[model samples]
Target: MVSQSAFAFICCLSLLLTFAHCKTLKRDVKALNEIKASLGWRVVFAWVGDDPCGDGDLPPWSGVTCSSQGDYRVVTELELYAVSIVGPFPTAVTNLLDLTRLDLHNNKLTCPIPTEIGRLKRLRTLNLRWNKLQDVIPPEIGELKRLTNLYLSFNNFKWEIPKELANLPELRYLYLHENRFTGKIPAELGNLPNLRHLDVSNNHLVGTIRELIRVEGSFPSLRNLYLNNNYLTGGIPAQLANLTNLEILYLSYNKLSGTIPSGLVHISKLTYLYLTNTSKALGLMERARLSLFKHFPYQAEYHLVPYLGRPLLRTNHSATLPHLTSSRPNMWRFSLWRFFTR
Candidate 1:
């Protein structure tokens, strides 16, 4: 039984409240501006206007997204992948408290990652690959409890990988390849329950590679493991057989010794196996040849490259296992028939 004037007044107040709530905050705009300034002009362009989170139909900026936050709009995502941006990783990004995904990979960015990156607690994905970043990864990165995908590969990083990386429980993919990391692979890496892909290849890593197998029931979900071209010395642990879900394994160009554990042959899921240049790797190669030849599909590839001082096949290299070493397409055809018929 309200009057028309009273009802209209209430409706007007609701419209005013909605208008105030949809506007972008001044702090978010400031953070975005700082990030652009850090990247310089050459890489980031078309950011001339001040209203980044505009009230228009299109997005405010080139690589920015805005979302509602109480009575204000805030930046939720900032993606600048392969945009040829130069300069160091922007520290001002930490100011965007609502940011969930930050992709600045495949650019010419230089300098070490900022330590304040740990402040982005809500971040789930952070990609900074193919850059010129160097120095050791900041231990503070472990603070990203919500991080799921972390890519820092193809950089100039040196020094031992921080053990703190194991602190990220939700981490699934970790790529730190083609860097200058030294020291034993951290045993703590096995602590990651959800880890599926781990690649630390082509680095100067030293010490035995058994640390990854030390933890019981570790890496139960691991699918791909690549630790090739390191200075690793020691026997390949039989525990690797426990990773029943393992699909691709690369442990080449190392100084490892001891007979290849027969348990590895039982891993039915393993398809791509590369054990080139490791001591006594031929033992497993020869033993598993029959099983692999009979069980695996044509798509599976096994490379047992001969190293110096120990040549598995010499002089008659062209004749030895001609079917196995032939053109890849032909080999796949041969292997397919051999596996099904036998």
Candidate 2:
């Protein structure tokens, strides 16, 4: 029953496997240690010891997430969100080459995002929102070909929104709102076929909204588009009606002029259309038509009512149109209720 030769061979193979495992584990441990040190290790005291990946299914560190890769486990995610970790962008993350999700949102991290972030080619979700980080976004971020969700909102980031972001073919959600970002929205962004939610609202953006319509099937899958509280000018594009899946459209507090596109009513899925205080130039007749659509599903807020210092449709007065008077009394009440409440 005791075959020394086979037993020795098995033992040797086991040692080799252990060695390989240690090599991979050590690399991740070193990187994590560096991150802890950079962010002040006292804050992440739970990240103690040399094995951040832990012994079995659980990780030794608080925010570390690992997955088995052959004989060894590798760190795949590091969610240190809202942990009060302060300092510059933790450059040590670049060392975790296998990391797929890096969420450090709501931190006190400062300085520009490191270009070394590009090395994490496997990153899918990078959530750095609500941080104190500043400076322009690194163009190297476009190197993350597999990225899907990128949230850099509510930061102090300035300069033009990076056109390089168009390189992410897999991107779905991109939030860069409430930043100091200026310049026109990148026309290249409209080319992303799978992008579903894009919010660049409350920035200093200017120029015509036409940049987004440069591509034929622009924002083909977009659902919620927020471009409000900016200095954007020119008419609302009729092509926007092509976003048949769009549900919430916010174009308020801008200098947009010209007739409200009639094609907008055709977007049957649209539920919320916010055009409050857009421009005084919008035709009163056109505004009245938008407010009175019988089939319009959700509340629509136009600049026509109180902002223009008069009621758009005075159903009680002689000024009420023949069409308005002839309409079912219930339909008129319903339309007025939705318009005024908004």
Q: In candidate 1, what residue range of length 10 has the lowest lDDT sum? A: 333-342
Error of 1 at 149 (Å): 0.3
TM-score of each: 0.80, 0.81
Error of 2 at 313 (Å): 8.4
Candidate 1's C-alpha runs over 4 A off are: 1-21, 55-58, 279-305, 308-342
lDDT of 2 by residue, 66-164 (tens): 776767778999999878888899898999999999999988999999999899999999999999999999999999999999999999999999999
The global C-alpha lDDT for each of the candidates, from Candidate 1 onward, is 0.76, 0.78
- Give one digit per residue, the lDDT tens place, for model 1 in 23-103: 788888898888877777765576766656764443478878777778788888898888888777888888887888998
After superposition on all C-alphas, the RMSD of every candidate to the true structure, in Å, is 7.5, 7.3
Residue 242, model 2: Cα distance from true site in angstroms: 1.4
lDDT for position 199 in model 2: 97
Q: Of the candidates shown, which would achieve the greatest TM-score relative to the real structure?
A: 2
